[model samples]
Target: MAANKAFRFFDLPPELRGAVFSQLLVSDESIILHDTTFFTLPSAGNWNFLNVFLVNMQMYQEASAIFYSMNRFTLNAHSHRLPVHLTSRGGFLSEEGKDARRRVRNLTLYLTRVGGEFERVIGPALSDMVLNGNLRELVMRLGPPSSLGASRPPERDMEQRPPFQALLRLLADPYLEKVKLLAWKAHLAIFCPFHLRINSSRTDTESVDNQGIAILRNSTGWVELDWRAMVDVYAPGQKIVRIGDRTY
Candidate 1:
């Protein structure tokens, strides 16, 4: 009888080993970065696979990079729920935290409002990420307008809106390659490339309307989205600045 040969995980080719690691570690949903812990939403099923990084030093370096670089992290911008402290030096990141921060490419900021206070807390953090970290794409999720009950003009100019102005400033950062804006009420999705020129006098409503029409005409999955209502809300006078391609 032949003796059973010892099997080794490292014996596999690098590509195959990487594929296996990706299957085990990659997540389809955005990873929630709450406080100091990193986890996928409960809907993605409970997973404690981070411990796999502790198997050995070689695995630690390779897997940790994949974990941080591949996942999209959602950071809450609300003052009460802000996850990390921003400092002039490096904030409160540990060695591993620093590595992860530097490796992370995509980030989403969930904001209660796009007011000055929100900018104060979030602006610096974003600047830090762009300047210090390797952030490639950014998504801003703005909550519904607080003045939904108040009587306001049917259409306000985009330049006059505080939130819109804040958004323009946020997108001015050259480091970000892609930017997406989502408003709760409008269900509006604005996709912008890095070089998009924002014209204060121009409203993006028409462009977005056309884009939405095109999406509905061509896209089979997003037929349920109310593109007309979204376009109408901004029709009065609200202008959407010229951005990148229409994502949907």
Candidate 2:
């Protein structure tokens, strides 16, 4: 009887190998990421996710690039609209010299409000990484509507809120085209038993702030972002006025 040969993945051509890798690794939909994404969600010690890459160096190198580059990652947040889960370390991408973080091409932030930072993850860290890094797109879920609501506009601008300033700066970067800016209509369904059209129905006939709020409300839930309106909404604080428009 003839001896049977074992299958060797490395034996395939690099192009063919990448094609195969893409099939196994890439996802048509985004992968929702959290602090414990690569870890055990239930503490069952299943160890079945990226741990598969540990089989060998070549497999890890080849597979990781396709995975991070081809897929979209959505980083979730707590109910408070703050990403307390993603610290300065930034859990997943920040791992092992940011080999994975640098490879990321698409990222989305899910939040109830346009609030605080992921510390070093999404602030200056994002712009700095996007310089040489493969990050080509970013999306943020602007909200369901703040609990504070339009009547009580919290200090929710980029400068006042923790992450908005950094995020706005990143979106404004010439490298990232205008079309890439996207967001979901912030829903205030959580307060629905006591809900009805509030800010969403208001016309721009009111104050200047109400005008910006009107523009933002026109979005059909998830849609390409309006940077101009965003700028109007988060326009510089009194400090900037005192110093002049030089900062922006």
Candidate 3:
């Protein structure tokens, strides 16, 4: 009976095995690799099967080159290898062992400043991936400003800070069609309203600050601003600068 069984999985043929492996890797609900329940392995749980995979020469050869897509890489103070591997690989995907690094669309960057030093070297390859690829959405949440100490700075610096420019540059993407800012603080807010007409159709155009409102007005696109800071909207033939909404 044991000999009759004859390693059922191995006997199924290489193509079948490869197909199954691909399905397992791509499955979102069934084959989970991250945070899980009691039955499933935890993120930090040791992967003992890795050694077994490495032992079989043919398996090792296949596994060595295989890059699974639709994967999640989590990181923290406790473990370091998971992030390192994903970043080193540049988050590239292998569709049956074909490289597709330039096709990545979604990214969640959680960067932290450790011991007053920014760790860019943690993932140089990933940066290459972004630079070389077509990125549709870039969600970056930098830990915090390293320089903001316990003591607050002068009021003049706050007003003069170029936070708006930095944010605009950060959010700009020529291929980007949709943009969303989760929670951000800055000097100016630029809104490109959905399906807004550029040509004149008088609807509260007067009384806005000319300089502040001119940039967005001339652009021919419109978006509703949800600003945390105070803003001044300016347009041509406006007597005085004024901010209508307290919170937008």
lDDT of each: 0.54, 0.54, 0.34
Q: Write the per-residue lDDT of candidate 2 for residues 47-71, one digit (tens) a residue.
A: 4647647779998888888877788
How would you encode candidate 1's per-residue C-alpha lDDT over 1-248 as one tens digit per residue?
A: 34697668898998888888877777778877653344554344666786788799999888777777777887765443444543223442333345456667888876654555555545655666677887778887654344222312222353346544545655555567777755443322332111122444643332234222111122222112222233334333434443353355
TM-score of 2: 0.64
Model 2: residue 138 alpha-carbon error in angstroms: 1.6
Q: Which stretches of candidate 1 lie above 4 Å from their native place?
A: 1-6, 41-46, 78-99, 144-167, 186-248
Each prediction's Cα RMSD?
Answer: 10.3, 8.7, 14.0
Please identify model 3 stretches exceeding 4 Å from their true place.
1-15, 22-49, 56-67, 75-107, 112-124, 131-139, 144-248
User: Global CA lDDT of candidate 1, please?
Assistant: 0.54
Worst 10 residues of 2 by lDDT: 188-197
lDDT of 3 by residue, 35-151 (tens): 111112233245443453445887655542332233332222112223433333332221211134343345444433221112233233233444564445544442222322222
Q: Highest TM-score: which candidate?
A: 2
Task: Report the error of model 3 at residue 129, Å.
Answer: 2.8
What TM-score, computed on C-alpha atoms, does each candidate reach? 0.57, 0.64, 0.36
